[model samples]
Target: MTAAPRPKLSVILAAYNCADFVERSIRSALDQQGLSIEIVAVNDCSSDGTLAVLQAIAREEPRLRVIDSRKNLGPSGARNLAFDHAAGEWGAVLDADDALQPGALGPLVQIAEEREADIVAGSIRFFSHRRQEISGAVFREDAPITALGLKDFVEAARPQNREPDYGLLKPLFRIGFLRERALRYRTDIRHGEDFHFIVDALGAGARYILAREILSYIYTTRESGLSRTRVDYSRMIAETEKLARQAPYSEDPMVAKALTRRADALRMHELNVLYGDATGLPSKLKVLARSLTSSAGQRWLKTKIAKRVVH
Candidate 1:
């Protein structure tokens, strides 16, 4: 008898202390129909029973490959390791707490092949585990497919925009495109790493297209997620600053404008932190004065004052 062919897509999942949700995530990937896919899961030295859970699942599911890490490599490192071991032409990221919709990979792969795109993304539905309900879709549904270049992506990521970050939308990327460009998530950044990776891919001139027709991914907003537990304003500011400075298209006028907007948002975050930490009236005044010194701070102050007056 002939052996089964290799999967066309590899779903890389970096799991850390996610024993409660990892099994469901793996099962979701395995349940994907109409496509040949493999789940490459790496347990990053999870303090919980995540490793044992993964190992047990792997024994039952042949397509699920589990890697046990000796040290805690975090999400980026684990994902990089998984990428090296993946044998698929296309790669997809699946968070341990999240799951993919049925028939997700087939349509994404078709789009990538048809357009010769390096990245093919679709809408994501945000599901609140606490509420036990899916909130809504992330991407706009008006267009069938929206093509984006580096400049366009940067602009859409601006703070003033109501649209969701394209990074939050799970994308099916060509393995060759990522390997050829040496695109990997930065291990240094704890938060906003996904955004940085997406930016880097776009900056490296990867063709990105959004398929608005299908909401293929479900992003579960769990109470245990980093966004809920971590509030490191300074680290976030530094990451955004680094992104602006190191972007390949930093010299472009449009990219520059987007960077400026991001910088302004960072400044606003700083001002908010300062104000929140102020103990007394004098301290609050000092914080306000310091915030008003910079152009971004001045705008933030004006906006705050405007809201107060309106109320």
Candidate 2:
């Protein structure tokens, strides 16, 4: 009798100067149960030992594949490179510094198979430096933001102010859905590209499935990390606005409300971080006053955009 085809899943990890953790990360992907995983890793021109580590892992594991770029393309660019090479029914965008827990992928893939879900999200267990589960909860586990019922579970997962530490973990995704929607990582988006990718996919009416199981994702909270530095305050604000504008809001009131609220919050945060002036105190206060008079929730957004022009 002929052997059956290997069960395949493409795990894409973008690494930049993550030599300390890339090996463990690769091992986590390899250790996953009941899946023939093609580990597609990209070394985004890391000055550190990231490439060597990936090469070493590739030698040990035949399934592991490494793509080396001569120049540093950011996370989105690296993932795009791997997307071209991925050959699997599902794709996962995993960070290099973080790792997946054993037994996470099998069940997640099962959800995708049964529900025919384009995107499958699972609960997260956020960890500290010591690799302990500090907290856990479903992403956007609240009303209003999560009130889109099944949709909130699919995209727009904001976990703050809900549970102890709510977050959206690694989402198992259908490769065909991404191709059909013409969705890929936005190259210009550095801070929240992953979030934007998922939302954009959902905006195109992509089917979603939520896996209720909690996955222990080891997240390192080191200061000198790529994640800490990528957030351009101005760009983050603009991307949120873009997301709000692009969403098919009329289709779902809950999604509409959540997008509006999220946009407002992004505006507020950006203004607080970047909306300052050296052009006299009075002029700044006048600008601030105009912002307040505009709208209660969206006033900050006006100020944020105006600051972008003046400063």
Candidate 3:
């Protein structure tokens, strides 16, 4: 009898101070079925017990490879390092703080191969540490997984805005596709790096398929995490403006509409933050003036004028 061949996948788990949740995240990647999985657990010089936890896990699981950095590098640097060390046919980016559901990887691999897709996305369910067994406030399911079908699914997911805020759907990617396109997370931006990365992949003519059958990711919301910080509204507004101006969807009507909606939503959220009670009078006044003087502000004004004139 012949033995089954290993389907190679490189799973990169970028860790930085995720000690409390890193174990679960690694286990999820390790649990993947029907694949020759190499887990690259890169520790970005976490001050917490993340490195120790990763070491313990690595000792237990032969597939889990730990890269403990001497100095603190951000998520982008960690991910890049992991990818550099990974030797697999496919690559999956797994956040250190998140968990993958059972039997998630096989479906994505199947869908990507069957559809000849460069990228395959699956559904995600959000959960919070505080709310035990409460499911989540938001869960998203992408379109049906058919051969070469992603336009409708992309349209449906466009307005979700923040990439990581929603797009944890699936985690199977062709390593060759990333290497060919030279797609790496941008290290400069803190808030919207994933968004920028996705746009880059899309612009590079990447093909997409949906893993519609599986719940591939479990995204956790822990209040103690970095996500709970107050936003720099002025900076975020600028980011939104840049996103609108630079998104490759300027020529695609549906995508353009979705981008516009996302821009508006982000601007509105930031505006509230700028004007919210937590802000002081001088800061509020400065932000207000900046908002009115911004390029986005000018664009908004022109759009309103054009709408009224047309109406």
Candidate 4:
């Protein structure tokens, strides 16, 4: 028997307790036109009805497949799990709480084809529960950016910029390229797994494409999953630091320097979160003491004071 045709793209979606939004999100993927797509969603041990929502959609939608995990494997683990079952040549990350903009895939796929890029990072927009566009795309561009390199990626991702963090942008990946390099999301960090994955791909010499104008990924500002948990900034720091110590990442002196700067910025974020989470006078005092005594913390304090003065 002839095999059924493969999908053009597989949406690597991992959802947790997002039952209220998961159905809408899955329908959005199903409603997409001009592309034959398959949705591979993993239910990461959600306490809510997220798994039921996924299973319900799967039973009705032939293109949608749901996997129920025995335990919570975090975002990276769940996505990695979905990817293992993907049958498409290309892949795109979709959050369970977010929906894809209509007709978004065509232009992204076009850009990838024309540019011969393995990855395509598109612009993002925001929405709310009221079905309102809370904010527009992250960039205003009439054309897409191509041939973006490691140095560019690192600098764009650096914290404290007017531009949104590049790491936050979800880019489409060529499944073959990722498989060629054995590139997969790092399960260690929850907050910055995309950044780490993209870095690994770029380091492995995959061609990068940037779509600065196409708002392909629509992000919802709902408080769930990662939003519900306290982010460990140190995980991001350690992951970046680990990359900085590796060969291809650290080989380029300038790239290595950029990684160091990024790590420092992450350290600042770590200190700020700790300070904000500190409750009693003793804990607060301890944070202040650490900031006062350490060089990295001193820089953080200086930046903190600088921002306060500026505002």
What RMSD, rounded to one decimal, does every model reach?
2.8, 6.5, 5.8, 2.6
For each candidate, what TM-score against the reference? 0.88, 0.76, 0.76, 0.89
Candidate 3 residue-wise lDDT, 1-311, digit = tens = 99535438888888888887778778888888877788898888888898999898888787888998997667777888998888888888888767787777877887788778887767677767665442632433554554322234333443335433333344466778889888887776655555556656766877876555577777665553634223354554465456556545666666665555556656655655555654678986665565676555555456545877999
Output candidate 4 Cα RMSD.
2.6
User: Which candidate number would show the highest lDDT if scored against the true structure?
Assistant: 4
lDDT of each: 0.81, 0.68, 0.67, 0.82
Any runs in candidate 4 off by more than 4 Å, and if so which?
130-133, 222-230, 273-285, 306-311
Clash pairs for candidate 2: none
* Candidate number with the higher TM-score (1 or 2): 1
Colliding pairs, model 4? none
